[model samples]
Target: MPWFQLVANGDATDPNDYNAVGGPSCSGPNHICAIQASPNTNNKPIITTPLRNEMITALNTNSSSTNVQLRTNP
Candidate 1:
């Protein structure tokens, strides 16, 4: 089945919080938003195409699947 996998570290899966579309991702509520981008300590908020494109390029994966990559300011 298609499922959301939370990669907490490199090639590692999160202990909890796995959903089809990464549901229950936010602790605030079970509510889903129509917004495309939401920045945070856990999730990577996407806004610009260049940024999105660069991320995809970095993924370096060859699959017709949706992937999400998160990073923090260092």
Candidate 2:
């Protein structure tokens, strides 16, 4: 799944400040899930508008002092 990792100064090798965002699964269709919502119907996960907004807020808040990196894999 795609994920976002927050690291200190955008340095992933630091191993000090690391926060991951993305890991939620739903069994049914059209179900609203949090963050990385994985549904059973398709490979592409549906990201609700509210969830997307929240993520953007979080990224903006943390990005001021740290670096947010969007990673495609675990």
Candidate 3:
């Protein structure tokens, strides 16, 4: 399987209020989006990409207010 990061708005208590790292907007009662992880030649997850890192950093910074979590789908 791949990995995904969940970004929840507000309290994160509602399952429909979250979205994937690189997915579409979490509108209505949509299911969890899947943002595939970037793996290296060794099949290991890598987050060195500038865009990914930027997104993660933004999420972390916003975590103080919202709920941002890093989850892996193994």
| CA lDDT of every candidate | 0.33, 0.36, 0.38
Candidate 3 segments whose C-alpha is farther than 4 A from its true place: 4-36, 64-68, 71-74
User: What tens digits encode model 3's per-residue C-alpha lDDT throughout 1-74?
Assistant: 24343454432222233333443333333323223445446543354465355545545553211222333233
Model 1's alpha-carbon lDDT is: 0.33
Better of 2 and 3 by TM-score: 2
lDDT of 2 by residue, 1-74 (tens): 44333332533222223333564332322212233333324333344566456556644553211122233222
What ranges in model 1 sit over 4 Å off? 1-44, 61-74
| Candidate 3 positional error at 28, Å | 27
lDDT of 3 at 60: 59
Q: Best-fitting candidate, measured by lDDT?
A: 3
TM-score: model 3 vs. ground truth: 0.27
By TM-score, rank the candidates, best first: 2, 3, 1
Model 1, 1-74: lDDT tens digits are: 12243333322222233323543232221121112233434554433465345445534542222233333222
Location of the lowest summed lDDT over 10 successive residues in candidate 2: 64-73
